[model samples]
Target: MLAARASDDGALADAATGQSEGGVRWAAFRQGLVTNVLNPKSIVFLVALLPQFLTDRSTWADKSVLGAVTVLMVFVWFCAVSLAVGAFQRVFRRPGARRALNIATGLVLIALALVIVLTG
Candidate 1:
């Protein structure tokens, strides 16, 4: 049976059960979690944007609820994106599709880097 592997990393999904070899790829999950948590935009949002909705009248409970909701929404968004990508695994496996995706992602990353350099 053909199984799915996310990358050169040992993250594998069984063909029959559609589960990872062991379970959740904790390493990858941790890496992504840390990356997202430390992202400048996320930091800015948390420091600046999140406080915009708060007032002197707001309490710790309100702040906690808002933070929890933000976390939940981000989790849901990432889960949806992961599922969508998994659904198109076969398409992504195609050489043409893979190459196109790689090129597009590379270009975007390069552009982002250039922007950061110029802005900084």
Candidate 2:
């Protein structure tokens, strides 16, 4: 969302179609949180994976605390990633900068594809 706002191309979906930048970020957070909570894949993974660490004495409270901690860690990591990406966007949001980046990215992708095809 921040990247799109930072770009001249207007590529990102308006997760928050509002008057303020904070609103957009809040919307993005809510969307991500709700999506993660509702996603069956995540639930299945958590159910399947979290139990490996459990012992016979582990209770629901223990699971809840672990889940909360896991969620907090994920949120912190997300914040860091968003901040880094947002800072980069702020630096390279100009039309000319975006064009240069696009060209570079395209060239890199083409080179990678060529390398894969040639080597494989």
Candidate 3:
């Protein structure tokens, strides 16, 4: 919802300014948050992974604290990634730069996926 609104608002603003494409400054950050929160598989993985370090006698407060810390870590990491990507946007703005970036990123993703598939 926030992403759609941001995109629409950005598009309108850009159009008024004669800019063809809209900037995703805030939209990308919101997208990272939404993707992290909406992923059920990630939640399940977190639940399964976190409990391995917890004993049966561990209190709810302990789990809550651990979860909060984990979430904080995720927030920090996402912010760092978003900032880095945003900083690189200027370099990718040239003609054919975005296409090259897309191809490179796609290849990296495919390679990572293949590694995961083969390892898992």
Candidate 4:
């Protein structure tokens, strides 16, 4: 958002960034950090699952391998998503595109809810 705001030229990006560009970046990081740090499920998973992987001297290597694979997967996923989104961004910005997209998403979610409820 901060990067986009700096490139806004007082256009759409400016509107999205609000009054100050710097504030949004820090706020986003803070929100993510707080949510992650405070999540009990995260704590429980770290305590319960991670310890099993640390059973021996080779644990460090196991953790390193897992972390490396996770980082690589995330990088690959983001790259793919970035390319796909970049390609579709222009289409998304067209008039009434957001409204149509939102309605389509809502319908799909409603349909999924109905299916779940009916199945149960």
Candidate 5:
């Protein structure tokens, strides 16, 4: 998830720096979503992680409810991130700004990965 977020951020940063048009922005967003949704590992992760939280009472109806909640959460998170990144588009348009943002995001992702690894 963090990696996906970083990629989204990187794309946004690139757009900001390059003055990308609406079509470009839409393409980037679609690419990011596809990259994330099509990842096989993500399916494996959902299979592994969600089942751990499943209960004996988790019938098909319950599963559907949980699935809906999960989808809603993802929607909210992406919307928030998109809005936040859009707000910074002008700031990231300056030369070197996008590079710095990428570096910072990369560092954050690395740090998060390390923490997950060490904790797990």
Candidate 6:
């Protein structure tokens, strides 16, 4: 997808950078929602980390409060990131900028793949 977007100068490229005329892309939004919801790493990390802040006598109420706080913190972090990205949406919408970004992202993914292959 990044490779295709890098060379595209049409609707596909535009949509890739959230430049669709009809506004939000529900399909992509749904995909992202599903991916985040089903991410086991987050679940495992929270399960492992949260217990460190509690004791053997910790009540259910205490656990609930801590879980709520963690969720709130994650929500705030995502909101801040979304706002930061939205602020730069105009720059990303530019053809040259989008192309460069897509190429850079593609290179980053390739580098990550190489690292995984070499390490494993």
TM-score per model over all chains: 0.66, 0.61, 0.64, 0.56, 0.62, 0.70
Residue 97, candidate 6: alpha-carbon lDDT: 83
Against the unseen true structure, what C-alpha lDDT does each candidate score?
0.76, 0.76, 0.70, 0.65, 0.75, 0.78
Clashing pairs in model 6, backbone N/Cα/C closer than 3 A: none
Question: Which 10 successive residues of model 2 have the least lDDT summed?
Answer: 1-10
Instruction: Name the runs in model 6 displaced over 4 angstroms.
Output: 5-35
The 10-residue segment of model 6 with minimum total lDDT is 5-14
| Deviation in Å, model 6, residue 7 alpha carbon | 6.8
Give the Å error, residue 16, model 5: 13
Top candidate on lDDT is 6
- lDDT of candidate 1 over 1-120, digit per residue (tens): 022233533224454456664554665577789999889998887888898989999999999999999999999999899889879978886766766676688788889889999999
lDDT for 38 in candidate 3 is 92
Q: Model 4: how far is 114 from its true place, Å?
A: 0.3
Identify the candidate with maximal TM-score: 6
Off by over 4 Å in 5: 1-22, 103-120
lDDT of 2 by residue, 58-112 (tens): 9999988988987898789888988898888765656667777777887888898
Better of 1 and 5 by lDDT: 1
Q: Per-residue lDDT of 41-103 in model 3, one digit per residue for the tens?
A: 999999789988789999999988999999899888877987897797566555356555566
Colliding residue pairs in candidate 2: none
Q: What would the per-residue lDDT of candidate 5 be over residues 13-104, giving only the tens digit for each residue?
A: 44466755777778778987998789899788888878877899789988888778887888799889989977987887654576676678
Write the candidate numbers in order of decreasing TM-score. Answer: 6, 1, 3, 5, 2, 4
